[model samples]
Target: MSSNLAGNQATERKRRIEKYFQPTPKDSLKQIAVALLAGGGIAVLLGLILLSSQSFLAVLLFIGGGYALVQGAIRKARYKAEYEKAEPKPSDREMDRTLALDLQQIEDRAMHRLGITADHLETGAASWDPVAALLADKMVERPKKRPLVLYGPKLSDFGIGEDGVWRFKLYEVLVICPTVHHLAIYHCSLDFLSGGLSMEDTEEYQYNHVVAVSTRTTPAPADLSLERLNTRDPEDDEVRFAKVLRRRLEVSVSNGQSIGVTVGITDEQDSSKQAVLQSSGIDEVIGSVRRVLRDHSRP
Candidate 1:
């Protein structure tokens, strides 16, 4: 029936996504060949020009082509070196182990901060489509590697305000990037009245850019000034949401990197509840991310 068809479609979509993430050695080799060939072609054209006319212009052309060929060779060598150093993709068992460890670490941190264990916390691999889609709209260029997103347990509570004018719902989404040494946390909420929309807002924060692993509760070390803030309002919620989460971590190339954290908040009825949840959620995620980064940095 319709349910089965929908299930089949979902399965096919996931299969395609997984296939896309698989490494393609053949395609990489082909790209290397193409770059080298293009460089060689430029060199051959310059040689022909020099044979016809041995002038200053011909020498300049020769030098340009030589530079291109050298660059191509360098790139090819880099590609080969990277391929050699690349580790094989983890097996299903290994992935499961990694996921479990990541979840357990986050859960431990959450329990310590919230003072209550999240028994109903759900865990799963976050879909890449949404992340990719957001990046496509927000970034001029995509990241070299698709970030591995693992959704940690969510903390949510609902209550009716004393005035009875609106009901308040507070929830925190803890999304961790286990593969990468940074985090971006978004906290969004909706305020509506009798099935009608009222208002929605989002805020973002970026964190640590040091090569050393350290814990600090300050504004993210990135260059987020008043001038960088957007002046116009966006029509689409997704567009606005993506904009709020578009900041990147300043990573150090030498001694690894520190955890990057971001926080977004949207409140409708009670500011106190929103602030408390937001602060606790941000603290929990930052601690969790720092723990993961420290473990990765250790030899």
Candidate 2:
């Protein structure tokens, strides 16, 4: 009785989670059987109706019906066997637990690759926000801790992708601390797409090596960072509605270290609301950079 109850529960759970999964072999086979059986029955019916003058056609239809019926029977039997056997264990999430765990390990490894030591970050004054961090650490340029700051392994957008496979572009962490005669920047820029971190080579450099700093705010299309990579299409109403405001603050080093961050506001129909919110966020972050530039303020 207990075994039967467990099997029924498992089946129920599988059915509930079906939306996240592809149709099973059993379900696929069953559907195929339904279609083929209907086709076969129709053929047999037409064959019987045409048996007099359409005798040859009737015979061919009979043969075709037999073939379809045979295939349908085979599929039905397979589906029955599968149903009787068992359903696959289901998860509430689309990705398996093991895959999720492995993906986390990949994130950790990727962070390490960028030369941001866990110990160094842990010892910093500010509590580490997984999305953004103003960190205190010894950098390659300074080779000491006190005078340096690392801004983040921050995401362009916060929140998961709707389809369980979202992408977030990791912004270039800024390095402008107070009282330091020259800034020492560490950049690990790239995209984290579809549960995998697709990152560039981590770079470290001094302020004097910087070639330019450019900043811009513009109307953005559907979020390229959070959504899957898609070519821009002709703007329909929905596409135009997805447009929000975005700001990019970029600094380029002499040796090809392009450090930048792109931040944007939530997409909503209220244009004024979006602008106000976006400007607030952009100003808060950009103000820190501006302060560092203006009078070497501690951030």
Candidate 3:
């Protein structure tokens, strides 16, 4: 009696779960009608051929139907096996612990690279408000109703540049949302313009338009230190440095409609700055964003 009661409870639970995913009445009716029409047509055709004294044709029809049914059953079994293999077997607590550890490691690495403490680091979900405001101020399209999560380090300390005319602060933000993920935004603010251009003159320049996106690639490590390479022989240096200078990521969207800017974190025009950016965990961040994009883009 106890065993029967347990089985009944298990069956009831399954039914409740399946109820949410069950097809609508309209869809079920349409599928049934199609199946009936196809099966009935095949049966009628085979029956008519059998009645016409075509014993050989009837045999062929039976053979064909049997082959088709066997193939269908095989395919169904294969699909079920594959699905079972892919399903996670771990307990919920185990999965949660693994995920938590991974996130903690990522956060720690990011904080170390950005020179920020734990207090300065905000959870991805909490950081979206500032990003939304920035988008609104720039008249950019706001993200959809879907959840937006962003992991951002606090702004860097203000410092005056060598030119003495400009003081700036720099920081990086990581955005993860339903449609967009692992998006890294490098931000900079200059206290004043150095080239006779007033602060007002640069105000018209849209910084948001500078956003860009790229897919990351892992290249074999090579030493490209200029000091170690022969500076006198330009050709030799170029040949040796070529492999090291290869881009770690390829641009996907430049001035894209979704992000409203080219997402390039480093300026290609400045080779020195580009090299520095590459070494400073920019590739890792971009790689994360690319992964998220790929996962979400799938049907």
Candidate 4:
């Protein structure tokens, strides 16, 4: 009796869980209808071929009825299986797109308020593969005038992607300006840009350089530093961004020398910054950032 009671309880719990996760009747019906149409059509074709000698009208009706029954049953079983199986969450691409849209609005607002130049916008996932190094490798192939700005590796230091793939996802934006000095890549510092409404311990990264953009609103280095990455008003635009920070230590097998590009973002502005970084390579990126600062500081 106790065993039977325990089994009953287990079954009840399972039924409750099923009720929680199962798709609505409307969704189930849609899936079933689609499946039945597809399967029934195939069954009809097969039946006609197999019973070619039988009365055409009889075969037609028989096949139609048989197909409906079999297909409906199969679809119901398939739908149940689908409901039981774990479903995949939405992709990180959704988050990246949202972040991109928000950042663009922010840029527009900032540009309007500050009277600055607004550049092109681009967003995509940044993954740490040998492929990323190829981006670095390709940078060497550019013309002498076009320098490379190693923005740093994205998405290994703990950031979430659109699909909830927090382990290996990166959100990037690139802005292309005219000069080499304008190239700068800002990453989301997992710690700083995150947290409360205020941004702190801000960091700046340029071609082969890293500096704190601001420390609790305190000005740090003038060169390669940003006066303002934000538009200074929410009314100006929507702010959306994401970043991944990672440290890579490259050690030589021949010589014991090492250097690394630590990836991170300081603000939503980095998403806009990335667009510039991608367009003109490194030199142009640096130039753009400097120009924005110069214009922002002008009386």
Number of the top TM-score candidate: 2
RMSD vs true structure, all candidates? 21.4, 12.2, 22.8, 20.0
Q: What lDDT tens digits, residue by residue, belong to model 4 across residues 110-166?
A: 333332342321211221112223334233333222212232323222323322222
1-299 in candidate 1: lDDT tens per residue?
99898678656533432322233344466487567759766775877767666766666767777776777777777666644433243333333233334334443443344333233222122223222322232212213322222231111222211221111122222333333333332222211111111222222222333343233323322443222322111121221211111222222224353333223222222222221111122333334445655655566
The clash number for model 2 is 0
lDDT of 3 by residue, 100-137 (tens): 33333433444444344433322332222333333232
> How well is each residue in 1-299 modelled by candidate 2, as lDDT tens digits?
99898678656544533322222343566889988998998999899999997999999999999899889998898887655433352432332332334333444554455445443321223212222211111111212222223222243442222332322224233332322444434344433222233343445444456555666666565444323222112221322334455566666768775666554443444554321111112343344444455543234
Scored by lDDT, the top model is 2
- The TM-scores of all predictions, comma-separated, are 0.25, 0.39, 0.23, 0.23
Deviating ranges (above 4 Å) for candidate 4: 1-88, 117-284, 287-299
Q: Is 1 or 2 the stronger prediction by lDDT?
A: 2
Instruction: Give stretches of model 2 more than 4 Å off.
Output: 1-37, 41-57, 63-182, 189-199, 203-214, 217-247, 252-257, 261-284, 295-299
Number of clashing residue pairs, candidate 3: 7
Local distance difference test, per candidate? 0.34, 0.44, 0.33, 0.34
The ten-residue window of minimal lDDT in model 1 covers: 190-199
